[model samples]
Target: MINPALQPLSDYTFARLARMLDGIAPAAGKRPILLSVGEPQIQPPAFAAEAIAAGSHLWNKYPPPKGDAAFLGAVTDWLTTRYGLPAGMLDTERHVTSISGTREALYQLGFLAVPERKNGRQPVILMPNPLYHSYRGAAMLGRAEPVYMNATPENGFLPALDEVAPEILERTALCFLCTPTNPQGRVASLDYLKRAIELAREYDFMLAVDECYAEIYRGVPPAGGLQAAAALGGSLKNIVVLHSLSKRSSGPGLRSGFMAGDPELVGRYAEYIMFGSASTPLPIQHAATALWKDEAHVESNRAHYAENWRIATQVLGNKKGYHEAEAGFFVCMPADDAEALTKQIWREQAVKIVPVGLMAREDAEGVNPGDPYVRIALVYDAETTEEGLRRIAPYF
Candidate 1:
């Protein structure tokens, strides 16, 4: 019943996994170890639970269409500290809006940003090819061309912005880049982000950087879009960065994140969300506000992930393509043949993994960007993850 704008959107990997195994049980009542989805199994912060309970008194009142003032201030303070921004870089009142998570904001960007024409051509949404499908879906639904750029190892796992043809830039309306990227776990450096922001300014498009995985890393905290924006200047002009409590606080159920950038875009996004947006519930918003303000739990969560990474390295060791992720909890390693390997692991080992082909798109360069790869999510509790590895280790 929805319009044609949404008719061609591709199914997400998890949905496909659901369909492929329909009418099937995982090894006679055993829910086969699932290392396919990135949902975190880390225990959520204690303060979040307390905040939610404490804020329950406000449930009778309708939540603000824009988030509560204190909530916005909390986000602003966190940003100021996290990125060391000049006070004006993010105005608590005008430059930030709360979304359930980056995923929803990323999806809604298509509705707000995509246009019929830019410089007299179909608008383009430039993205890393094997990307979060929302970028492409938003492009298609908004009636724009989707420009696929290679973000694989040969390009240092960052899209080659300079290599893009000028013609494409003329019509580009939006560009999405993720730091500590999904599946591959590649972290974009500060220099890379500065170049990207420069390109967005030069080409006249909005740069939407996804920094959800910024908190989980091997060494120091991952370089974020906010840091890039700050380094370029204290002003958040052409860029909006989205960060979440999902990975940082181990609370995906909270479905909360903040988008901070240009005041004009934030104002417009607030309007769009006034009708179409799913705002976080008041108690949940309070919980998120608390989570953002406190970093103690976040540090503990990061340590846990690091420990998990150690366990992962010890189990898988250094096989071909077993590169250490600079950030994030995923390992993108090649399978001899992705689908065949997934099928083999599912049937023979009773373990489920997603084939990379379903996660990426093919381009004119004849690259199935996800080909020969299987994405493993180190998202489970340590014991479950160990069980998953014990079952699928043979493939590696």
Candidate 2:
């Protein structure tokens, strides 16, 4: 029999988009511009490849599931410098582990944290509306109730933890928060993060902070979860911050990232990885260590996204539903009807974008928070991004 949890899920975002446009052909003679997926088109630095090659001989050796000392050392150093955490505050052996990617770790965290029940009721996994699909999938497959905290303009596009009812918080087993949130690009403030961490500790839930887009900001570097944990006290209790080279170093294909936090939770997660997931290959770990150590490539990568966002503002700034994104690499704009707009853009301009409704679920009141918008990834070179934005500007 099919798992009962599978009954609640619809097709994934991209797969649903493909089905929606199955019969429609792109406009004749116009080259298709795909802005639907968040894949970065920039190439990572040459040194990454060199590091991988240098460690090529280790390909036959099974990588340690918890991670090797050298790679974990690099992560610890990077975290300390990037977040200004005090030296030795992070115990690499207990506070960190190599993840194949944040997506994999995020999904596995559901299994690691969620139990069959909380307070004798079905557990709740809280996440923001218009969330990364992985969060929803994790909660659902783990057999917990997925609670969506709608992040709309009324709340500055950041979900307010204080607004959640006390009953809901008590049953929460895991909570996922995304900084520089996907689609909306809003960053959670330091105070907000601290409050969230405090709530998680008080309610005794695991707080999973997705900071994968932490390095793609335009004006100032966004504050991070680890920073908040340090500011509150020296403890990493009840919080784990996830980082990835995907957006930071423009190396999604490398599939390298790590999660760091509470010693007990992290240790369990590391052990869980030993049985539940594949270890990151030694060569990839070597490349990732190099990528994490160097800020030059990340700076350059941010420049490309900055340029692309600038072009978006210059082209679509005056449009009715357009606003400058605070961070992250998407232009999520409002539309009268997102699905229709998506199809029209493909048919008329040969451009592809995602209807925001497809990425989010309806609330208890039956209103889908993403119904009024569409998400376009500005994850391309400035010129191509401009072309795509210009083509879809009229719809907004």
Q: What is the C-alpha lDDT of each candidate?
A: 0.82, 0.90
As a whole number from 0 to 100, the lDDT of residue 191 in candidate 2 is: 94
Root mean square deviation (Cα) for candidate 1: 1.7
lDDT of 2 by residue, 201-318 (tens): 9999999999999998888888989899999987899999999898899888998999999888788877887776788899999999888889998889888988898899899999
Candidate 1 segments exceeding 4 Å error: 21-25, 28-31
Range of the 10 consecutive residues with the lowest summed lDDT in candidate 1: 21-30
Q: Once superposed on the true structure, which residue ranges of model 2 sit more than 4 Å away at CA?
A: 8-10
What residue pairs are clashing in model 2?
Answer: none
Candidate 1 residue-wise lDDT, 191-245, digit = tens: 9999988888898799999889888887776777778888987667788998888
What TM-score, over all chains together, does every model reach?
0.95, 0.98
Judged by lDDT against the true structure, how good is candidate 2? Answer: 0.90
Query: How many residue-pair clashes does candidate 2 contain?
Result: 0
